[model samples]
Target: MLWWVLGGAALLVVAVVVTGVVLFVVAAGKSDRVWGVDDVAVGECVTVSGEDEPVVRKVSCDSTDFHFAVALKADPGVCAAKNYSRLWFGEGDSSDSFGKWARDGLCLAHVYQQGRCYHLPSSKETNALADVREIDCSSPPATGAGENYEVESKVSGMPECSEEQAEYFTEKPTPTGYCLRLLE
Candidate 1:
């Protein structure tokens, strides 16, 4: 009888612990200021380098909010043929002639808006200022430039804003790339 009682107590404890963990995760997602479709601007343009030429595309938002949505184009019949079926936000092939990988991640594309460099999650965003807008890239990619792609998975966490915007937004709080939320 005592053995059965102990087993029940152990199970109860385990259940409570698991429940607590799940609750914490849900709370964290909510507290992270999880972004939504309303947080992004429609028809944002970004530049991507394909095998032959550089392609420009637009960004899209998801219903979940706080996700990355970018499409790319690659030259046909190239080693890095642009395909829309995989994750879109990542570093591309830009290695030194000597054979060293240049950037930590793929320089997927150049985001529009001067003085602001946007980075998707799975890339470096630590040095980026707090004012940098962090978008969620978990949504499917939006179509652009006659391609069907989606920005689904990301390797890193938090996208970064341009350095110039980091400064101006931090200093003047104008409608600069540096600023995220509007200043009162």
Candidate 2:
């Protein structure tokens, strides 16, 4: 009876250990999920001006720790005034479309500082209390405006960007310019 009890206890311990190992492996796989952009969908964008959800994409580059996110959002005040411009979301291989918008709108306010991105208020003097980057996509041509976008690390998934700001994601556009963080 004593030997049987010991064996049962040992088996319990082994089961617990295996469970822990599996959990750790799963978490490790998701660690990279925090580092990419999502595709864009109409639901994510505001209908009035065709503004998509605000996005916050992290810039990955030459071993330099750039802890910042990009945002794109719309100001209803801007749209109410017949501003045909729209906000767009950019991910890996989807950055250029925002630049070629036929609406001739400015989606993102290029920031050089180190911090979170956010939306500009109706006043144009203050940003909304949200930390994100806003892009415009109101016109149909604006949808395909981006041509310089590209996807880099398949292992790392799409470029690591904050999804809290975005409402859509797309693999169609490739990222370009300085946004595509290339490892040297």
Best by lDDT: 2
lDDT of 2 by residue, 133-175 (tens): 3322221122121221222222211334443222122221222
- The local distance difference test score of each candidate is 0.29, 0.30
- Model 1, 1-184: lDDT tens digits are 9999999999999999999999999887544221222222322322232332222233342223222233222222221233121112223453321122222212122222322223322222221111123233343233231211122222132335433322211111112122222111
What global local distance difference test value does model 2 have? Answer: 0.30
lDDT, residue 97, candidate 1:
19
Relative to the true structure, candidate 1 reaches a TM of 0.22
How displaced is residue 96 in candidate 2, in Å? Answer: 6.1
